[model samples]
Target chain A: MVKVHFTSHLRHVAPSDPVEAAGATVADVLTDVFARHPAVRGYVLDDQDRIRLHIAVFVDGTHVRKDILAAPVTPASEVYVLQALSGG
Target chain B: MAERLYVSTRKGLLVYARDAKTWKHHATHFLGAPVSIVLPSADNQTVFCALNLGHFGAKLHRSTDGGVTWTELEPPKYPKVETSDAAEKEKAPAVAQLWSMAWAGPDKPGALWAGTTPGLFYSKDLGATWELNEGLWNMPERARWFGGGTIDPALHAICVDPRNSNRVAVAVSCGGVTVTEDGGKTWRVAGKGLRAEFMPPDQQFDPVIQDVHMLAQSPSHPQMWWVQHHNGIFVCTDDLQSWDEITTAPISHFGFPVAVHPKDGNTAWFVPAKKDEHRYPVDGNMVVNRTRDGGKTFETLRRGLPQGQCFDLVYRHGLAVDETGDHLAMGSTTGGLWTSPNGGDDWMLLTAHLAPIYAVRFA
Candidate 1:
């Protein structure tokens, strides 16, 4: 099981507290999280179902730089979703 | 004259309501979001706002109770195309911006037209659902279309014929003008006389590749149309079969917004700015060029306008004329808003500060 957490910015639109989900990869964990909060999917991914250009995902405190969705995640990993600081 | 106004800006949607003779800031919506377009339905009861959120992509909302309450609505989306892989799929299209929108003729209620970064969309249920006009998208000539001011090639102009809802005209910044007589069923390239000086000599006069900044049609004379092109200004009274360039602009011919008179075809106004890379007021003088006798003559009206060391750039949707054609409102990139009660002859500064106005409309 992995603990998924969303930043405060996204919390305004979806859940704020962390939730535990079972998955083997970051995408799998997110897929499980989205299943519960469907509206969060659009805030995290673009129309092409890809992680947004200005969003970052971290698994077990390690930044998933490339092939983000397919990045491997341990059973007891901490996944953090946050917006990048570049838009302004 | 209109008593209320809607201003879409970089930070949010600003509403100005008329209190007696003064316009006051009435409300704000979607604070901190980049509102690209704000449109009111034909009856002025339903208002729609398009937002280009930096991280969340494009979104839309509509208000039925005079903007006091809103309902989230699905924006136009592109059909997925088959791609080999994620890297190669970068070329796949998406709606970068909802550039422009228009209500269909009064006869066709609940019908709305929208121009996006790469395609035209039609909504039959007041934006509840949208369908792309594949006829225009599938045209082979669309290959020539490229990005102009926007990051992606955009269709920014939509003019539905006043007499017949079936006849419509749309202009793409870098893809010339196209018209359809049977609504969105079919389309044909128009603007024969438009010139694209940026293209090669042989293709300079090609109608399929003109970068039209904006297109406007006179409400009283439906056949009369005006275009603010990349190279200059043009007018076509023959329903866009051909265009005649206007060479008598007192200021630089380059501009973005063009508002035609409601009761007279020959009366129109444009906010001229430096062309191309430098898009500010000409010689630091902000003025609105008014032409009452068509393009043959123009009056450089600058009364009450800023001159000398000014840097205001009015975008395509920044200028609007009311139903009577005597009231006009103009906003600028430098956060300036001005209004004219008696046409463009004089102006009154509404506000010196607002979030870099993107579009303004009379309500």
Candidate 2:
């Protein structure tokens, strides 16, 4: 089970705590997460089914800047969705 | 929770209060279009707001009784140009939109400065009358068009050293930071250690050198200042003679606003957005980072903010620190308005479902 933590603002649409997903890659796990939390799908993925520019995924504290969904994931890994922003 | 909050939106300004545990909206409707920037006097009695009206022209509005009422200030008119030779008539300086306004002293409350899309203007008697700072306009670089067409060099940010009225710094969008030692009589470029090279043949002009978005000065250290550029964040010392890069964060460099701790010179704050996207909140997530030791390091603080997809862009004048020095408030494009009393660790929404917020202030 990969520990997926949704932020406070996103919790209104998804499970607040970690969710289990039987997948081998980051994309697979996120696909399962999105299946459960439909409101969060368009937020992390674009209309073309690609990672959106503003959404950044992290696997085990390290940023998966490249093909986030395709990145490998393990049962012991953690996933975070951070907003890509610049100034205050 | 008992503190008062004020927010500026596309419709006007909204005042709010925290009751029990929920935020109660107090009032709204003060300006037209979007209130791009808002500044509250140090006494917490007077408020100033910059309204963006697109090509219709922009103006500033002021409130005297703690935002209870507001009145629009007359914008400065461009002086008519004339030629002594009488052979050719002179055209007046092009009128540009107003971008930002700065008041030099909250103690005296009359010394004010306003920056526009084309140049800088000053008013010693509050907002009653104004004069153009010719030194800034006369700079040979200001007349040079970096990319084929002429750029207006919009003045987006301005900071006046609280300790010294004569010491002031102004940031021009598409123009770098400019400082004046003996008041606004003479100006100099403070663009050392900042990237000036623009990319692509057509876009090959230095936007970072010219387009400065936000700036903050340490009340304790007059020589120290922090700047937010369209490209990155920077720290400068010795009156902007030299600068150090502090944009190592994992956020995009194209942001609009930056704020410093009211009492701590080493602590500063910035809101980050996704670099590759539309430059709005990343996937609609709201995140702000605070640097306790100046700009050397930063940690993300999003405890109470939303994480869903939202397109809220915090403008250059939206973030402000309270007078009590215990709270920080910000107005967003989508999230309405929020306040964090304990710096940025925890936040609470002060208003709901307001227009796109352009600026915020406390009075």
Docking class of 2: incorrect
Judging by lDDT against the true structure, name the best candidate. Answer: 1
* Candidate 1 CA-lDDT value: 0.88
Clashing pairs in 1: none
Interface RMSD of each: 1.3, 18.8
**Candidate 2 chain B least-lDDT 10 residues:** B86-95
DockQ of each: 0.61, 0.01
B1-363 in candidate 1: lDDT tens per residue? Answer: 466788999999998876766578988999988999998854557999999887777888899887878887878887766686866666677777799999987887888998998799999999999999998998888888888976788898899988888899999989989999888888899979999889999998999889999999888998899999998999999987899999999889999999999999999999999987999999999999999998999999999999999999999999999898888999999889998889989998999888899999996
- Report lDDT per candidate: 0.88, 0.69
* Candidate that would win on DockQ: 1
Give a tens-digit lDDT track for model 2, residues A1-88: 8877665545545787777776888888888888888756644553334565556678999988866777888888888876665332
**Candidate 2 lDDT by residue in tens digits, B1-363:** 234566767777676654665446776645445566666675557777666544224566688886777776756545545554433322235334566777876554587888875668888776767788898878776764221112466776788878777778887766777788778888777767666434445443343344466777877666778877666788876768777778665555667778877677777778877653377876678888788887778888888888887677787777877655557888787746788878889888766577777676665
Task: Give me the runs in candidate 2 sitting further than 4 Å from their true place.
Answer: A1-88, B1-4, B17-24, B29-32, B54-56, B67-71, B83-94, B106-109, B145-151, B196-208
Q: For every candidate, give the share of true A-B contacts it also has.
A: 0.39, 0.00
DockQ (0 to 1) for model 1 = 0.61
In model 1, what lDDT does residue B302 have?
Answer: 98
Question: Candidate 1 residues A1-88, lDDT tens each?
Answer: 8999898887656687897888898889899998988878877876666788878898889888998999988888999998888644
